[model samples]
Structures are given as structure tokens and as C-alpha cells.
Target: MMLPWALDVARERDIPLAVFWIQPATVLATYYHYFHGYGELIASHAADPAYEVTLPGLSRPLRIRDFPSFLVDTTGGEVGKVVNAVFCELFEFMDEQRRNVKVLVNTFDELEPAALAAMREHLDVFAVGPVVGSSAEARIHLFNHAGADKTRYMEWLGAQPERSVVYVSFGSIWTYSKQQMEEIADGLRRCGRPYLLVVRKDGRQEDVSRCLEDVVQERKGMVVEWCDQPEVLSHPSVGCFVTHCGWNSTLEAMALGVAVVAAPSMFDQPTNAMLIEEEWAAGVRGERNGEGIFSGPELARCVELVMGDGARAVEVRKKVESRKGMARDAMAPGGPAERNLRSFVMEVQSSDEARRKDTNTISPPP
Candidate 1:
């Protein structure tokens, strides 16, 4: 969304504006989630693993138990508040949302053909993804400031053995209570996998005293404020991601052939986690307590499930690997995503041109 706005601003300013997009058709399938009754039915289905219900638009029974945990939040709570705020903000940005809104998502039409088919109606969306594969190269020039250890992350991974280290990072805005932090730390320790944890420098009460140091010492580990994630995930030494299921992270993990353990925090994260864990068969979902508390043991189980060389891990790893080809093809020169992007550009320009032609502030007929 910001990308589109920034491009539009550049266009309005008559400055250089280049827009690239990936993923159009896949996202529309999600709008089906926005329809009334869909969320609840999905939730009802999720509450009972054997529960079966019809998807709003798609004519199929989405097993209740397999539904993403966001169904719990659909009943109206903090999650519902967030969803409502998004709709409110959508109203506020109704004009802006439409104004040259060139869109991209981290998915492929092959992986989400049904959703993508639904999205073709929008005309401005492009699905050019698994961007993380191209991102390490993309971030090469992002923060070349002095004293920045750009390659330090890479070097760290180089030191680890193959598929031995697990990389952990809660995306940009997840805050944990002190106990939750220790819970995560404990899980990492119990899992006994070599790991790295990136804790953002936010005011999220992090009292890691409870066995955090012990856990790190027991297994060779690294904890930092932040690290070049795409680089880390891309490394062969990195086997799995215990993630918040952010769209970028999901795509990154999938692109790098790193299995995901979805500990989704909020907003679209749960939905994204669902896509990864349920729809894509690329990850295991963490256990959420009745109050939405993600149990450390469940987190650990998901991690081991993804990292282990078991049947599930093999299945998920192959699924993730398969998505890479789809994503790569989507981003190619004249692929669907690229074609959609060109069309999006034309639509935005056309809409702008039409608005300019209709800008006359005529007074009402006297």
C-alpha cells in the first residue's frame, strides 16, 4: 500500500516513478474473507477440527479444525477491533486506495489459482513474488551506512553447520510480555536447535533473565536487535523459521526453502500463517491458548516439526521448494504478474488522466 502511494506521489510530482508488482489474482480470494458470515463460518469450522462448512465464494467444505486460529478472534475482540479499524481506515483512504493503487503481494497464481482467478476483476493487482529470493540483492544498497555490519549476518550464518541453525524473528511490531519472552526463550532452549533471535528495540517488556542466558549457552546462539533477515533465511545453515507469519516473512521462508512455524501475532499475520500452514502445507501452526497465549511447548513443537527430518518436515520442505519456481516464474519479464503490473500502471494513469479531465468545479445549475 505504501509502495503504491509513494509511486503515485512521484507520478503526481512528475518525478521518476518506477513500479514493479507481483500478485494480483491471489489476493481477491481473500476478499471473500471480508464478506459477512464467511469469517464466522470459518471460525465455526476451525473450532471443530471435524467441522465442515462452505467457503463463502468457493463451493467447498473448509474443514472447521483446519481453519486458521484467527477464527477465534472473528467473534469480536482485540482482533475484531483491528479489523474494524482497517475497514474504517479503508473508508478514509477510499479515494487514496483507488488513486493509482498499484498492488503487489508475496504469492504466485499457480499456488493460489482460485484466489488469483477472483482477483482478475480488480485489474490493478499483480502477483510478483517470493520477493525475498530477489531481496538479499535488493537490500544490498538499502543501508550502506558506515559501521553497519551488512555482511556480518551472512558471516554468522557461514559459521553454522547446514540445517542446524533456526532463525527466529518477530516481525516489526510484535510486543511480548516478560513471561512470553521467557516462554519463547525457553522453547528455543528446549528445542535444542542452534538458533538466532532478533528482538526489536521496542518497549516490549523483555526480561530475559529466566533461563535465557542458560538457553543460549546450552546451544550456540545469537540474539540481536535486528539482522538482515532475507540474508539469514537464504543461508543453507538456516533450516527453519519460527515466525510471526508476516507476509514478507512467509514468502521469504517459502522462497528460501525454510519451513515456517507460525506463531502469528496479529492482524493479517494469522491469516498469512493460515495460508502458510493450512493452504500451502509449508508450516505448522503454534498452539494458542483460549486467551490467545501461544504456548512455548507448542511453539517448540512446531519448530521441531518443521526442522526435523520427519515425514511432515519432508512434505513441507518440498511444498515450500515447489513454490519457489512458481514465484520465480511470476516475476519473469512478461509473466502474469508483470503483465498485470503494466496493466495496473495504465489503469492508474488512465484514472488520473480522467480525473484531470473532470476536475471542473462547476456550480449547481441555477
Candidate 2:
């Protein structure tokens, strides 16, 4: 059976492996570089009051804000540790297209057309993406009777009135200061809306929730460690989503017809927020702390703007159609995604005999 040697067997059989990408094309474009000016670019942003960066090849101005948080670590980030510990072997397992294999990125093209175009010049990079959105149909009925009970979050939303609830979550990984969290709590209350907060399970809760105790104790609010988001957003009760503007969450909200209050933290998040507010007309940007929501009244105003029947509802709904169209086109049969699949098959077919003769490698590490 060669059960344990499945990867080797596949390589021997000339099966193509797919190395799906989730992070932005910009983050990855650096991998294929000998001189990306990465260090100088970061220094320029941090040093300049204008907060802009210009790299060797990019055409547009870079915001210190747009760079990924890992670079800011400057202190030899976990990337090095992770690279040595994990990616070293992982990258080795890949039979790179350099001109042969196919690269499947989960980002829709419109979101990063510039970087995507740059990447296409290098390899067979297909934009069949926002892979997260491929499951939209399943998310639409998120809280509908079936999975609601298991999530433990469905019942709470039913108790609120239509468009009266604001759901707050900063994604699976993001944090903020105690002072900033308190300010946002006050802002939400001032905005005069009922809210459900999904605070992180980390130690910051007690400090961050300093101002939330009164709201939590009262029936006007609820707080939990986690939530069933699609279920929560679909609830007739949730009026606005105060989110980190994650690509998946933003797209999922669109799929389920929920409005968003964008509060992007880092990485491509701000870019997503920029698109949501400036381009997509889907959400209003929230007051931001360096890597989290700035606590205060501005945060409150964002909640109110997107709540029930505001100026944004009509425009927001209409623009989502464009995004949906682009997203669907990527995943359609014989579209970019499908084309990548076909190319991958052909590559494997042509290389099977060569790989079978070489037994130096196998599967990626778990």
C-alpha cells in the first residue's frame, strides 16, 4: 500500500502538489527576490513623518501602514524561527513551477491588481480566489435552525430587535491596549446601540473590558470568548459588523447580506478596509489604534452610521454585487482556478517518470 509513503508514491507517480497561498501577493512577491529593498523600505516608513515608503520596483507609494506586522518586529521576527523550524522542509517539498507548477492564491484580483499583475509575469499564478468565499452558500444559512444550537450564540441574537445589534470581533488573532478598548466600549454605548462583543480569550479581557462590565451586566449587551459569525450576521437582529476587515469575514458578510463597520488591524487588513470604504462602498472605516480599535466616540459613530436604514445601506448592497461577480468569475469552471487545476495536471503528467526515478523527497511536514 505504501500508506506511509503516499507522498513519495505520488511524486513517483508524478502527481502535482498545490501550494495554496492565503497571504497577499505582495507578501509573497518578496520570496522570489534577490533585491526587494525590503530593509531600506521599512526604515523609510518608520523614519519619515509622512509615513510613506518607496521600494525599488513598485510604482505606487507605500504606506508604512500597508506593510505586514512581521517586518515591524525588526527584532528578527518569528519568521526566521518559523522558517528554520517549519518552512525549510516545506519549501523543499514543493516542485515549484518556476515555470512549471501552478500557484493558487486565495485573493481575488481586484483587491490587489497591481501585485497580482506583477506576480503573473513570474509564474502561472492563478487568481481563483478568496478561497474563503468558495463556501458562501454554507454561510448564508449560518444560524438558520440547524447549526445554531451547537454554536451557543444563536439564542442571544433572537432576543434583540431588528438592526439594534452590533457584533464586534477582531479576528482570531489581534490585540489592543487597555486604554483603547475602554474608549471603544464607551463609544459603542454613546452611539446608543445594543452590542454583542466577542472578546479574545487572552488575559487582556479583564483590562480591556474595564468599561464593559456595566454593559455586560445589563441586558443591553452580551460578551463571549467566540461566536458563530455567519450565524450571528444572518440573524435578523444584527445590524452592523465591527470587524478587522479580514478578507474572509468581509466577503462572508457580503455573501450573507450583512453590513460592516471596518476596523482593520494589520497586514492586508487596512487595504481591505480602504477597498471597503473607498471602493466597495460596503462599510465605514472605524477609528483605529496601531493594531486594534481605538477606544472612543469615533468608534461609536461608525456603529451608528451602518445601523438600520442609514445612507450606506443602498450603496453598500449595490456595490457588493460587483465584488460577488468578480469573486464568482475566479472560481467558475475553466476560469482561472479551473485553468490552474488543468495546468497542474499536465505538469504532473509530463514529470511523472522523472520524479519516480528520484526518491529524495515526499510530503510536507505536518
- Reference-based lDDT, each prediction: 0.64, 0.62
Encode model 1's per-residue lDDT on 1-366: one tens digit a residue: 324355446546743333343322222343335343465555554446566755434424455433334444445667666555544343233234444444465566676666655554543446665555465445643323344465766677788889888788877667666767767877877788778887655524436544455565664687665677777877889888888877777777766677888886654565566678777898888867776677778878888788887899889888888876676677788886678667756766877777666765655579
lDDT tens readout by residue for model 2, 1-366? 112243455467656555566665655454332123355556445534347655433445556555444443344656644543343333334433243345677666675677678877765676656564333355443223342233445677787788788888877666656776677677777877788887655636676666566657666677776676766777788877888887778766765566788876655676567556765687788766555446667777777666646667667756665665666676677776677567667766767666665655665579
| Top of the candidates by TM-score | 1
Tell me the TM-score of model 2: 0.69
Q: Which consecutive 10 residues in model 1 have the weakest lDDT in total?
A: 18-27
In terms of lDDT, model 1 sits at: 0.64
RMSD of each: 5.7, 7.2
lDDT of 2 at 56: 37
